[model samples]
Target: MFKNAVQLFEIFGFKLRVDPSWLLIAALIVWSLSTSYFPEAVPGETRTLYTVLGIIAMLGMFLSLILHELSHSLVARSYGLKVGGITLFIFGGVAELEEEPHDPKSEFRIAVAGPLMSLFLAALFYGLTRLAADGTEIGLTGAVFGYLALINLVLAVFNLIPAFPLDGGRMLRAVIWQMTRDLLRATRISSRIGSAFGLFLMLTGAFAMFSGGGIGGFWQILIGFFILNASNGSYQNLLIKSALRGKTAQNLMSSRVHTIDPGASIAELVDDVMLRQGVSFVPVVSGERLLGYVDTAGAQSIDRSEWGMRRVADILVPASPENTAAPATPLDQVFKRIGLMPRRKLMIVEGQRLVGVISLSDLVHHLALEQEIGTSLRG
Candidate 1:
């Protein structure tokens, strides 16, 4: 979901990234704390002092979020799953686990880790607050910590609510999976519950808005909409992955891909390949060696006037192993790559030779056909 995220730090072998959307939430927290939260709680303090405290509270919140996500990542890694780093966005943070948990036990551990970490932090903060003296500078710090402890405790409890894609939802799914030994069935059940919860949230938010809740209601509605959409998407993607299970790039890839000469100019590519051949992408090759892949989208980056001046190599996306998948690679893995890809395609390679190409369109078409066939059989 994070298109332009900046890597903030590398923690315990996992990269932590801050998405642009995080700034929105961060600003909201800072504003809410500075103007209302801190001012009301710690009266008689200067505006500057309140602002500083707000910032400090904000930082504490950020740390808590990181620890929560890190807990998930660390647990998943301990189970031998690939940790694709964490991204902090408007909805807080998510650890990008490359693959689903192998079993219900693993899933249960991973799902519960974040909330447990939050609860632990809450306890630690509460203990700190208890140790501090009252009516002093240290007491004010303790009060801030106490507030943080409360928020963290709330976070833990809120996350334990069984909603799909959320920690609680995953826990629900794990429990169901353990009972039935059917991951897909468990996912469907949890997702439906999540959708229901999302609808409830939306309705409650609407009612709150009509009753003068204003921004809080609006925020609830936004979160509800996000959860609803994400839950639906999660289920759909699960179905797609299940259908594509045991399938490989060779199952869906197109062998007859048009190749572009590295020496050819962008104008030539547009005229000959795009306009005539009706192909959006062409592999830029020097003999049998795969150099890169060029598309009309990349060509648009340069001025149309410069099309004749620049070579296809200048506009091509570099052929990295990361962008190329083996013919034997699972379709699910290919789908994951396409999600993160700028070009929205993968080159099917056998050793150093490009055997075929798999685009986003190909995978979607394949999945659609599979779904249709399954429906027909069921009917």
Candidate 2:
């Protein structure tokens, strides 16, 4: 979901990525700590000392955030959920789960894992702070540890706030889901509450700004907007998931696929397939086996004069997970894949044999038809 994010490293088979926006937040944290927090907490420290301490503290906070998100990923994996990766963004971090929990209990466990991990880290840092402190002298080490302790406590408490997409909001949704046995209803109620809470925060922030609360007020407003957007997006995603439930790629793909031979010239592909049929992409096959695909872009990449000389195999975009899905793949998963792809399409395959092609337009048409016909796709 994040663009231009840098992959930091991999831990326990989970990739860790940091978005560029996070760099801005990280700099703000360092500056705030060096100028205000550290100087105040450790009096008489030099500017250089304070800066060094701030940098260390920032690094510690980064590790703490990773651990918090890692906890969530680990728990979800235990329940057989596929975690795409952990991404650190402007707000904090998120463990991207490929699919929702199968049941409320799994959901509750997954949602609560982060806060619980944060709480543990808070206790751990508090203990370290106590150990580093002298009887009457709280040195730089003690101060840094104390700050980490408090921040971890804050993170735990902040994430526990009942707002949709937040740990607490998700926990609330899980409880409601268990009680009512309706995941959709639970999500709708929690997301509405989350949106209301976001509105309240924005208003409070506006009041703070007018009352001279300064940058803090602006920060709160930004966070409020993020939460509001995320809440609505989460609800919409659930609706799509509900609509596609029990459906597979086979049900959504267009079986009337137009395939091209590997030896077909780019000129033939452009004129015969693309212009005549108005199709942008055509899969290249050797008998029944899928080799890859050639699109209008690939054909155009070659000069028009050389179109007749270049073959489809020479300009083929190799088939991979990004542009292909199994016939049995869930429609929701296919939908997500298509959204992420530049082509906005996927080839449905059975083993190495191409079965059909599914595009974003096809999925949209299916959803629109369902709504128009008032069809209930629920099992």
C-alpha lDDT score of every prediction, in listed order: 0.89, 0.91
Residue 137, candidate 2: Cα error in Å is 4.4
Write down the lDDT that model 1 would get: 0.89
Worst 10 residues of 2 by lDDT: 370-379
Give the Cα error of residue 285 in candidate 1, in Å.
8.9
- TM-score of candidate 2 against the unseen true structure: 0.81
Cα lDDT of candidate 2 equals: 0.91
Clashing pairs in 1: none
* Clash pairs, model 2 backbone: none
TM-score of each: 0.81, 0.81
- Tens-place lDDT digits, model 1, residues 1-379: 6779999889999999999999999898888888897777668888898788878988899999999999999999999999999999998899998778999999999999999999999999998987874746445687679778988998899889999888999999999999999998898899999999999999999999999999999999998888898888888978897889999999999999899898999999999988999988898888888887998889999999999999998888888987898999988889888978877899988776889999999988888998899769858
